[model samples]
Target: MRFSHTGPAPARRDDWQTLKTLWPYVWAFRGRVTLAFACLLVAKLANVSTPIYLKDLIDGLGMPSTQLTVPLAALAGYGLARLMTGVFGELRDALFARVTQGSIQQVASRVFRHLLALSLRFHMGRRTGGLTRDIERGTKGIGFLLNFTVFNVLPTLLEIAMVTGVLLWRYDWIFAALTLATIAAYVLFTLKVTERRMVYRRTMNTLDSQANGKAIDALLNYETVKYFGNETYESRRYDHDMRGWVDSAVRNQVSLNLLNMGQGLIITIGMTALLWQSARGVVLGRMTVGDVVLVSAYLTQLYAPLNFLGFVYREIKHALADMERMFDLLGHHQEVADRPGATVLQADQASLSFDAVDFGYQADRQILHQVSFSVPAGGSLAVVGSSGAGKSTLSRLLFRFYDPTAGAVRINGRDIRDYTQDSVRAHIGIVPQDTVLFNDTIGYNIAYGRPGATQDEVIEAARAAHIHDFVASLPQGYDTPVGERGLKLSGGEKQRVAIARALLKSPPILVFDEATSALDTRTERAIQDQLDRIAQGRTTLIIAHRLSTIVHADHILVLEGGRVVEQGTHDALLARDGRYARMWELQQSRTAETP
Candidate 1:
């Protein structure tokens, strides 16, 4: 299947667009946002006015003047104002948190929904852990922006403007000019340095992603690495990836600290210079000592917001990058998407056919070349071949996992592509070579193929799969917990459970890909009876390596290097002494040697 490069990770643009798109998510909770803004305004008003009370107190009762009554009253007023400011600040924080949490939940839900909607092929190549990280980062990134952008940066900027405007009207024009220059300089310098630091963060994020992928890959293939005694090799690869991550992280931290230190120094020097001028004015009677104290206090308050803007700017950029990658995934286009005006199929009376079909995973390689075959409606057929000879690929084509590069696959004498993907798959039930079971009860796993099936229907299907008795003997019977992937069950038990699932689906067309390959002779023989019963009224396609299992199949197609070498009933193919006959002889000899 060809994957179109369409998603949040656009060629030239990172996730910035996705972050912008999240405005709507924020707007969804407009009432909460409005409340947050109101709280923010109250907090800022209180915060910006605190220094004014100190100015009034100092002016009303001269310092060291022995005016205890006036001084005490001024102190009380300042304390009360501060207390109220703290309360509103706390309220604003709570409101900001509420908005952030809501936005995260909303984005995470959308990403999860889109992830599940993607086709199987897209999932085949990606690690589960990495995908999980992307989803988490995407959601949290948006949340971080919501909390910082609206609550911190926006309110702080508004406060700065209010302070500067008041300063200009009440004090010298030089104080206001100095405040503006200091702010503009602080922002410009911080932005300049942080832009460089962001390069390190971007590098660090890439290395982190790689490190995570390595760990996930190793964990998923732990069994293979252990069997091959390649633990040292895997560990070395992981260590190498981690080394890069650590190096980039260190650089990012160092660069950020440098930027913060410089910003602090600049603010300190700018405020000191401004205060010196204010003190000179006070001595000349143009301003008072109380006014100098006010000017100094407001400078600190104004720069308080400026302090964290550097971090917020950097984070917002990274957040945008993360958002882009997530959006890109949500926007992926299926090369084999159903055409417009597609219809759902209702008929089960249809023949399955490969009409001169050609397909490949890559442009230069063709796995199926002009393959043509027809299985009569309600007939059973088996395809036999070595791995990668197009047997399994043919089964996938039957389900439209991939559209043929050329030619057409037909059902009921109509092209299968005419039906929507869901419609095409709804009529087919597949028991793949490897069965995957969820961590749930035995009954849940059985009923997964038909979610609304009754308890009796589930038990009947299990009985037909020959696993009902085994499950009934368990402590919890149908409610017995099946560990992840049914790890608690033996190989044969898992296959039987899978068979039960497929049986319960009750689709007209059934495809088995090495259904009994993992079972012992006794188990295989027992299930063969159920298989025979199930195949009686349905169209079945079996792909198997064991020749004995399919001897009863009405027809078997022998494949070699993507071509059909021979095809016939078991007796006729045996007499022909072709590839199928040789395979049968080899398998029979092996069976005879078994204890």
Candidate 2:
């Protein structure tokens, strides 16, 4: 299995151009979308006919005193038509939502897979909580946009056009022009206010992210906060972020209220003019009393959908902003890719070599400068260096976590990057300094190294790491759950469990990174013996802070300021009286003080 670190999730964009790119995710489900559009057409036709039915009923009622029976029956039929239309419209909305949700699933799954393919460098620059929020917003945005755009907004616009046309044909140019101008004004005003509201919404999202970041920071460093008694400080900071969010929310609500008020004003003005025109036509014998009633009724019905369209329009815009952020994550280029016709490694030979390599995390600051070293096939080499001296960078390059900037790292005399990354790294095992164990059973954690490993193999590896006795002593033995990061275990116990995991991998090359740094003298000695035994007849690279850990290695390389300053056995390094000699002298003095 391959594990990848996720990068920073995309942030929301204000541009509508971003929304155009997201249309492809929905296009993948074009068949369902076509069905939704068909349903929308049927639903909208009913919506437009509803007002006409009411007009006919009003005309029938005012026709004459002797035709009461026909008008009553017509009223009943119109009511039934309205009822059926509502039912059909609701059913159509249900179908549309189902289709929309499926499209959302496809987009979200693709984004998640893409995020997992990103390189470790991307993750190092981001925070976990921000990424989580981005994904949540993205998925929700897709669902919102699909439902509103397909079922509500499109149908409403069609209804507006039909209503405008009817007024022009039935009444006169005055009524049609008044209705159209008022609607145009309503839409233009709503758009103007919405643009302002979106700014507030963006502010709210930013503050919300800050609050989540603060919470995550506190939770992950719970121990540090408790040690420093900084609970009040953290609480105050959280409150400050939340307050900013509230301020933005208040601004957004005010803008929305303004939109609603503006809509009500426009509706009133349009309806008053419509009523005045219908009354004037009746008095002049150009229309009847029933025509005035019919015109008044249809005008309000038309206004209802138009008024709602404003709100839905704002929501859709916000949703699009969210979706743009999400697709941004999916668009990130993969940091590493397999070469054309790359093949898996087939050789059993185990060797690692770095030939005049130069590397850096950034362009101007080199982490390792012109470094050259080689570990024999099935032999051990220990790399010793101070902090920031490129010891860990060497290990990362060896595992192909990163490729060297200026030279090649070869495994079995093959360039590591030339092969498929999975195949290249599969034969190497690492025991990381930070022991990260999932909240799972001890057996599962041990077997993580080789997913297909049997129960006996897991137990055997645990025994070799000197952790079997501790595991067996637990109430549930191998079945006992390890808490998050194995926090339930002692420091030395967690280290041993990590070692057992690396051993179970059974890779041809083994790596140990200051494995016993957290252990006591006796525990270190016990595990050190097991590590030495495991290193035999295998290519091993040990990075050790404690000089005693790698004292007996076949060869020791001392690094300083990204360059190799010393190379030899322990005895030879002590005789040089340089950086390595000073480090040995400090260890000797510390040992003598241990009375």
Candidate 3:
């Protein structure tokens, strides 16, 4: 359930370290925690004393001469003790509620923020479904661990101590010794069995995540699944993981039964021994019936929590296991982080340059090689190349999604690394080749380009992208839900929405990576015109497969096998009859044969 990142392996955390990590978040509300503990102590005191009162009531009722008197004082004391235990226990929960929920919120928020801050490299390799499930389970574990550790585990231990002290003081060392021995045996057995069962629990978690991940991945690719008619295949794939999960879960339950049975047996043996000793003492005329009753009452009171304590320890271990993955995610070192005191990018008209840059998704497989290019402020540079020729890589470099492996990418004559990532991204707008939109209203998706955009601004950008008329025809218009990843819309429609989004952003630099590939011939022509208009007086970098689209660009660069083979104006490149000229001729012939 852990992910490998581009750094040293994440440190393995023990249960104590996991609990320690949670302390800071819970400690923020120290006053509430203190008050809750106070309530817990008072509640346990009342609970432990209740059995004492009950024993007195029973003994008083047994007295031959006093039987008719009704033992009113002892009865009232027993009732009041029970009432106080319930009241204070409820109060403890009420006081601790905010602390539990607030800690969950803070920890969840921290993990979420850390996920966002991680580099795209980490996310690209991550399984979204599994990652989300980890976060969900981890946050739930936080609440469980906090509530149970404080209320159940701590209170149980305290009650056991108090009960054992009472027995030793009022009765004999033998009673206390037997109580402690039984507790120790029960605890040792529970710990050993639960520790062995942890493998099954951890297996269940891994399989559950795998099953969920497979299910979500299949659903996200529903169109692809339908195209290949593989619905049954997907189901079987998911069930493969589920089958393992079921096995692990069954094993977990079986082990739990074993632990429970062992604990019960230990308690039963101890309780019988204590009661027998009490009865013997009474027979020897060394103890009264009330003393025997008191011993029985205390044993009952002590063992109940002891049983609960076993359950708490097992759950706490499970909680620690669940939280390990989430904290490990938080522990991942950010692959690309801004330097300390990095300044904001200050560019009125952004000019971009990649100088002698080399990069690869992996070090062994270079994607771009010694690539150098520049687009002056208010100029248009279009790159034409076949797929995987590093055309799109140029756009990624300018956006600083990945820093160049050699040399540097500069904005306004300064290394982009010198500026904060937020500011650098803020100055650039991109309409990516494959556009994915949020599952929300079209208006909302468009406004995501520049959040809090006014309705008028959104409308203006939509009109400029040539999607306004199409949207207006729908009954819901701007309010229409786009569905997951904008699947409700056609590919061309999604592309236009992307265009509208970038237009709304209105950054000084713009990148269009095969922006019009999704559009039909007629729509392509129209959208191209709009793109041309928007390119005016902005530094625009276009990665194009179509030579026709870049015919009017101020400069054209031809990339082949991750290298810049040719660069010049359109007329200049055609006259040279080089790589750019052959690509143009091939595309032109294909276009001519289209009709």
- TM-scores vs. true structure, each candidate: 0.89, 0.89, 0.95
Tens-digit lDDT string for candidate 1 (158-224)? 9889999889889878888888898899989977887666666656655566667778887767778
Please write out the lDDT profile of model 3 over residues 1-595, one tens digit for every residue. Answer: 3232122223345877787888999999999999999999999998888878887787777777844578788899889989999999999999999999999999999999988888888999888998999999999999889989888889888988999888887877998999899989998998899888887877788888778887898899998999999998889778877888898899999889988999999989999999999999999988888888888778777788778888898998888889987777888988888989899987779888889999999989998889888889999999988788998888777767788899899888899999999999999999999999999999999999999999999999999999999999999999999999999999999999999999999999999999999999899999999999998999999999988899999989898999999999999999999999999899899998997
What residue runs in model 3 are displaced by over 4 Å at the alpha carbon? 1-13, 64-76
Candidate 1 Cα lDDT to native = 0.82
Off by over 4 Å in 1: 1-15, 63-98, 348-350, 452-456, 475-484
Alpha-carbon runs more than 4 Å astray in model 2? 1-14, 61-65, 71-84, 288-297, 330-341, 439-444, 452-457, 476-481, 571-582
Worst 10 residues of 2 by lDDT: 1-10
lDDT of each: 0.82, 0.82, 0.89
Q: Which candidate gets the maximum TM-score versus the true structure?
A: 3
Worst 10 residues of 1 by lDDT: 1-10
| Root-mean-square deviation of candidate 1 | 4.1
lDDT of 1 at 566: 91
lDDT of 1 at 295: 88
Q: What is the lDDT of residue 520 in candidate 2?
A: 90
